[model samples]
Target: MPKTKTERVTISLCPPVDLGGEPGWIPFDAPSLVGESLRFVSGEPDGNRFRARYYRDAEQHLHARIWFGPETEGPPGHAHGGAVAAVMDEALGLAAWAAGYPIVVGNLNVSFRNMLPLQKVVTVESRVISAEGRKVMVHGRIFSGETVYAEAECLCITIPGK
Candidate 1:
């Protein structure tokens, strides 16, 4: 028997929903010196692929709530590894900035534990683990509740000026 084909549907990749104003969390405002040029997760507010909200805990660790939208899919319903890496990169890099270091990532190492489902809200937590001269090391994880999807380490260096 031949299967019937249905008409294709059109979909728009709209921006993710806001997850701000959670209890015991304070919003971390990124510096606007870069103006509108930066294009990653932290730079663009209307980014359709991924949506992230930066926050600081009482202990001052950098944490974020992220939504992996449909546009980031790579394997079936899961998010692309690059998309996941990009999120970790931005979150971990911002951790350095939040800790008062104006820097750029020198190297980013990401380990995928499990595939992340699209359109799901996940939490990213980061800490500045070590600092030596111009080097800053940050560790982070992407998880939903108790399920960890990925972990990353980002080494950042001071951006010479500012």
Candidate 2:
């Protein structure tokens, strides 16, 4: 499969919205940031130039918004399947990390539901289902805007901290 070229975006995250429907300011990088938040996930492997920025949207929700350039093309104008899986793995793993457990993939099951266009933004969402001791189970979906492109389920186990 061909590689996917990605670009990072400069973000201006929105402030928190109050339950009372009023303006509430929550710092983007604050610990107790209510609602969704985004953290930096690394790009493609260091030696590779394809840049993919990942984000942790919440304690249980992880997101990856990707941009692949024209050079990275599959089927004329679609993203490669392997590229999509890689993004899913990274995003889902981070979701596990966000829930206070860093993990390895115990197992992963993915289904490619449709063709995903290249050079467009792709977003991934992951959520933790539950946990058993060091193992956390997760499920996620990849979207091309409002369209579903792929879905995945993963089991992750935390490694002991040094």
The regions of model 2 sitting more than 4 angstroms off are 1-41, 44-50, 56-60, 70-72
Across 99-156, the per-residue lDDT of candidate 2 in tens digits comes to: 6675777888889998887656566667899998888999999876578989999989
lDDT of 1 by residue, 1-162 (tens): 876988788766575486674589898775453334236675545566777777889999989998888778999999999999999888888888888888889999999999999888899999999999999999999998789999999999988778
lDDT: worst 10-residue window of model 2:
18-27
Local error of candidate 1 at 38, Å? Answer: 4.5
lDDT of 1: 0.84
Name the TM-score of candidate 2: 0.64
Q: Which residue pairs collide in model 2, if any?
A: none
lDDT (Cα) of model 2: 0.61
In angstroms, give how far residue 64 of model 1 lies from its true place: 0.5
